[model samples]
Target: MGSIHHLIGDLPHRSLHDLSRRYGPVMLLKFGQVPFIIVSSPEAAKDIMKTHDSIFAMRPQSEIMKIITKRGQGLVFAPYDDQWRQLRKICIRELLCAKRVQSFCAIREEEAARLVKSISSDQAHLVNLSKKLADYATDAAIRIITGTRFENQE
Candidate 1:
């Protein structure tokens, strides 16, 4: 039952787009027991996100998320409640404030420069850009967290 049949063979986004064209900017579709309100237009999205954010702020709970987040304890998966608000405030003040982020700018820039230099140095061969970028990210995160760079991946 539901609109799951409409999405049988096509990609979800393509199917949604086709349905939106037929239905209009805002359409409701049900996938099994869950009902989803699909907003295809920018205006509708702004209305939902900006004008009515609190009404739609809560995310659906899942067994996997509960296990990963220790029963919705962290900021990312926690319910929209007092604990989540306090966690958000503390994170903003202590970790993600403008000054705190700016303090790590030098480390990020240095890592980026190192990544570019590494790529340039290996111009003769097929450089694995994905792995290099992942390494750069790990190095930068480690440096920022511990204030020391790893020596030979130690």
Candidate 2:
């Protein structure tokens, strides 16, 4: 209650924890567009998950997630409705099967080679590992999805 408002605005963990320490464990913080009530107690969780779970079922979709989902084109990004289930059918069966993956060991080898080459060739002592990994992953995922490379970051 002291400065819970100042501590957390977007991510409410700090403020919620502070309040729970001040008050009881089950701290209800009614703020922002969504009313976020942080329940630290196991007793409160039993009620929330067991009793009021359905009422809190199906998380509210975020705008950024929706946009990055390409309006729901990605197989993983799609909701767990009929379309997602339908799309995931082939991905589960043929695309990601153990045999299929083992057969495509060459692909993994190639990607590993790419990463190794990048690291070796870089003059900079500290490379942006995240960006480098992102480049490799994006290339691999795009190739898997479309059978085409958008751009070679190399």
Candidate 3:
């Protein structure tokens, strides 16, 4: 019986680190129905990621991911294959090209300015910098890609 319940209320990664300190650098954690092997040591991590990359390169697939991906139509969760390779090339050339990335610079600068102004306005108060940066990044990306900022109330 794994102590998965002990990690339920806390951030999973932080919990894993605590458990690894108590257990060992390498530990097995079972989260409800999912079992995960936690590797904390640099040597062990390198062994798994570099020496055995092919065996662990793909992410675990779930029903929700399959539905969202339309059975591997997009790049995010597509399996490593000829189709994924072609899709990656198209994405790099069309979506992430130099010209396309440069086009988003103005939107990024504007969002960054807004973020700086918001932060400067409340320097005396404790600010959630992480959340603020994440929100700014999301707004900038959406505005650049879709030509509109996401309306929170919509």
Winner by lDDT: 1
Candidate 3, residues 67-101: lDDT per residue as tens digits?
A: 88888677878887788889989999999999989
2 or 3, greater by TM-score: 3
Question: How does residue 42 of candidate 1 score in lDDT?
Answer: 99
Candidate 2 lDDT by residue in tens digits, 1-154: 4334656587666666666788887665555555666788898889888998756654456888888777667676666567877888978898889997787576667776888898889876889989988888887777667767667735
Which pairs of residues collide in candidate 2?
none
Error of 2 at 141 (Å): 1.0
Error of 2 at 60 (Å): 2.0
Worst 10 residues of 3 by lDDT: 1-10
lDDT scores for all predictions? Answer: 0.90, 0.73, 0.84
Q: What's the TM-score of each model vs. the native?
A: 0.71, 0.60, 0.75
Better of 1 and 3 by TM-score: 3
Ranking by TM-score: 3, 1, 2
- Give RMSD to native, each candidate: 3.6, 5.1, 4.2
Candidate 1 lDDT over residue span 28-136, tens digit each: 8888989999899999999889999988888988788888889999899889989999999999999998999999999999999999998999889999889998899
Give model 3's clash tally: 0
